[model samples]
Target: MARAETRTHPDTADAALLEGGRVGLSGRWTADQGAAVEDAAARIAGSAAGAPILVDLSQVSRLDTLGAWVLERTRAEIEAAGGRLAYAGAAPEHRILLSEVKLRAAEPAPAPRGRLYGFLEDLGKRVVGAKSDLVTGLAFFGEVVTACIRVAARPGTFRGTALVNQIEQVAFRGVPIIVLISFLVGGIVAQQGIFQLQRFGAQSFVVNLIGLLILRELGVLLTSIMVAGRSGSAFTAEIGSMRMREEVDALRVMGLDPIEILIVPRILALVIGLPILTFLASLAALAGGGLTASLYGGMTVDAFLARLQAAVSLHHVAVGLIKAPFMALIIGIIATIEGFAVEGSAESLGRHVTASVVKSIFMVIVLDGLFAVFFAAIDF
Candidate 1:
């Protein structure tokens, strides 16, 4: 104990300091005393660098987290400046709290990751995500094939009620819109052909373009696209909602395969329904083309009918109709896969539903292109 000199703080919080690097804290050092405590700690740290300092808290009748933090901060600053500090005469509880605070305060924050590294990491994750989606799609496709085979072997296992219901929903209900859209498309094609051919005085050829295009490509393609957006999206939302409500899980628990019960009926319906819808859509489009040619292109109905009847071969009709079931298969696969992928959240349901429609539309277009190339190479 060297000769001690007393330094008293103007605030009641600090009380005084003694000689030989000793400081005394007093009174309630709560959040109310925050500013005064930090000020006193800073002064001591500035003057006592590399010196042995002792803190006397015997007079501190009360302490809280705020005051404990202040003292810990002072100790940290002193140690950083090459000084040694100690707490003496502290309560057991306070010592524990101060030690914990100091431990927490000393931990370093995580450094920021580099931008290039972040970009590479994100790209890798996306690639992995894309691969996962592809694998899931293929697995679902396989499940559909297996289920269809089983149904084929045991015809009694087929759910006719479910199949008919799905057909009514996905095909019958969709017929009006399909007819309207296909008619408009046919009329637009006829109008455009007439407009372009009028310059060459070959306006009679408008009937040929309308008939050939409607039968060979636009008929099936447009109908499939519409079905994918309308019915395909509905299928996803329906199954996804069932999945979210745990109905699909209940089917599994009851010893029934969800794929066979839920998916097969829809696939069967689409396969059976799309070709019929495609044919009706083709007829509607041809009717529109004939109307447009008669009214706009000034071609008589007989002439248009004769030209259309001559221009459209049965092979053209077969090509369009043949692609229908395949496109339906693609749409069904995409929609069902996305539906089963839904998580237990409304957000997940919405996202998967959107993904279903988008993926179905994209696949439908891709399949159309593939069909075009195949047909062209075979000179169909």
Candidate 2:
């Protein structure tokens, strides 16, 4: 094996090769030599002005994949510049190896990954527009309520069965999952509270912590998540499908108020249902927390119940229940607006359904944050 050496030839093959570092593989030219060879080649290519360079690999001790790749790249750069690079002084044993190993240099990837900033800016604009639609839909809900009052008084104006079915689907089928989530949340709160209060020898206060937080925050948050997944998406899909089928047009043609006959009842049902569900959720959460505390936290069920009584205020329960109707109204209006905005197509339906769920959940979270700030400020 021969160590590689550099020698600049005075009489070279081309005018391009006459400048500096024209054509020699530097250092030990072998598989392990790595970038030393490539660096030498790059230096040679960069030294001349629009000149061809021939690389002398004759003294190479060994040729490996890396050495071959570097040579191939150098050759490419030379050819790209309308210049030439030639191989010279190869060992007989290197013939078969060099022939077997070829380097395919990767093409440079294109720039601009579809203007990400512009795409996000456009998305932000659409989100602002969608929230505006939510506010407008909320205002429109007043007219819907008025229409509902008239329809309820008349009782003969709408399809009661269909409306009742929708309400049941929203409220009834959702109870088990709601109960499970609220119960787990209550258990988690109990664990945290026990850990904190145990420092003061007040482990039994876990019940109070669970009761207060669950009734106030967790109950509303969980219910909102549920409605976002369940009723909100359903609202979008229902109204979107109605739009797709032109049933909304049929209702308009019949001189019936779509707001009254179609939208209002659903919104009213959610408003009515959410608070009822929250109250049930509070009970279930308390039970779950009490059970966990009694079993693991060295608290008796009677003691847990007693402390729960002392810690949770009727005011807190009322506050949470109050928030539910507002949350429900927000979800209802947002979902309904997205549904109505859906164009008459299946793809649009899917898109709007996803949008409705997302918007409803976001609005619920924002509203919850506002509630937290306001209530915390007022000590509610």
Candidate 3:
């Protein structure tokens, strides 16, 4: 107590000489030491021939976390001031800390895209599965026909109001476009027929050629193609939306058979609708051929009608009707299967709708080919 001891503050003393290139740490430091480190670095930055500050951590044997943070901050500030700060000595622990910090700050690696092709292939398999299910659904066709017969036997099922809306969509909605297409198609067919028939000096046979082709091929093929684009897509979209909304599940919960209630009715509608539409298209096409013959081929309307009557056989007309209902069944089954296969999403719905249209078109063509072969073998 009697003797007064003098002690030096290292930071105070070193701050003056640090303007050139110096750093001091004589005591233990906490994180709060950053402010003093920054200030000292700033003054040193303005000095002539400013050199980097180097802090000696060799003596920092008892450093707390805050002390370590302070020492790191001082080094950074000194370096940022256009001076190089070197560690006189680095402990193994210090290297580990640096490595840990770097590891923590590193960016995450990217997700792998290697499985993309496999994923797409799996999606294709699902679509194929849906198509298979649709074909298997044909096992229900006889049941559908039985139900139709039951409904027909009662005749109340044919009430005007019940049918009017359907007729409007299947008939009126279809009529104008069908008429327009049939007319243009008939004119084209007539023009083509005239070329072939004229080779045989059989210009009058143009009527027979157009009528027979229209009834046998164009009626079934064109009608099916149109309905595939229009009604097949409609069925897929309708059923898919209902599936997504859990409405199909609701029907199941209520003990209503989805196949009988939903699928059968639509199939029935298309089967009935297609034949009716084909009949109308046939008449419209005949009218179109008559007009073409009258205007270009120098054939009168009466003569064209008579030639058409002679050319088209009752068997051809019957074959076309048989093909119509089968085509309708294909379209309906494919569409409904696609709808049921839809997962609960808008993208799935759209994809299924497109699939339904494509599958229906393919099935229609295949069935028509089969029918042609069958009829030929049977000599129909």
Candidate 4:
């Protein structure tokens, strides 16, 4: 027979090799033993080394959860290394503790994906999501139009106060920042134009560039983007909060059409307010361009005004204004759609609000690009 190997830990714990590959454990086996119990368990696992072994626990004076967990983990490690572990002579309480601490094996890690495969997977998901969003947006738009028709048929259902309130929120209060930003942008464009054109002795043409660009594209585009970020986000957050609190369901119970009461006024306000804002923003940009021309391009204010008057046509102004209501409708629809998607959590509300702003801005830009192509094609 092989000489018995023994590892002892005074009164705390001990592991002793016995006859027939049996490991005898003794003394207190509890949290109080701490490192001694851990050390003994580790020794048993290492010595087993893919061999069959039986752990005898009858000699144990006390056993607790920590001791049981350590023993179970050691057994798991031994079994994973192709060894067999069995407990024998365990007291009833010790057997129960061991059963409770028999932890399940951890799941295996996933295989690493190739970069191209990962990219394709992500792209496919985004394309599918975009398709779904487009279909949902169209359905919501139809609902909004239906609501508008209902309100038009019964003028008494129109919420004039709500419309006025939204106009104040979306247009009047937004004027200061919109004007300031448009002014700065126009001034920068004028300064750059003067710098580029002076090299060719055609600095006076910068006035035509500023007038056409601001009236035809930049003015309404900038205003719409700002409104999407400001008012659109507000719409989503307001409605998302109401959704979280179940007020939307309450409206249905009360026989009130949520779309007519909640969304129509907001969309109508955007339709009315955006064009007025576009006009104001264009004027502000023109003023800024004139100031920059006088200061940097060696042109007097009166001369700049004369050049602007001669360069810009009503057709250019009409192009910018015509895009406003469409962009407004897009923003309002996207905002309300995301609002109604919110779940009963703050995280969902915030996520949908952000998505509303991002989607609105992206769609606004796409719509503008499409309009640009159509206008170019038709010679508008």
lDDT of 1 at 122: 100
State which candidate, 3 or 4, has the greater TM-score.
Answer: 4
What are the lDDT figures for the candidates, one per model?
A: 0.86, 0.76, 0.71, 0.93
TM-score for all predictions? 0.74, 0.64, 0.62, 0.75
Give lDDT tens digits, candidate 4, residues 1-380. Answer: 25345545557787877878888898888998998899889878977978899999988999999999999999999999999999999999899989998979898998999999999999999999999999999999999999999999999989899999999999999999999999999999999999999999999999999999999899999999999999999999999999999999999999999999999999999999999999999999988988999899999988888888899889999999999999999999999999999999999999999999999999999999999999999999
Q: How many clashing residue pairs appear in each of the predictions shown?
A: 0, 3, 0, 0
Judging by TM-score against the true structure, name the best candidate. 4
Model 2 TM-score is 0.64
Clashing pairs in 4: none
| Per-residue lDDT of model 2, residues 54-95, tens digit only | 566665656666666666676677677877766666677665
lDDT of 3: 0.71
Candidate 2 local Cα displacement, residue 373, angstroms: 3.1
Candidate ranking under TM-score, highest first, comes to 4, 1, 2, 3
By lDDT, highest first, what's the ranking? 4, 1, 2, 3
Pitting candidate 1 against candidate 4, the one with the higher lDDT is 4
The deviation in Å at residue 72 for candidate 2 is: 43
**lDDT against true structure, model 4:** 0.93
Candidate 3: the clashing residue pairs are none
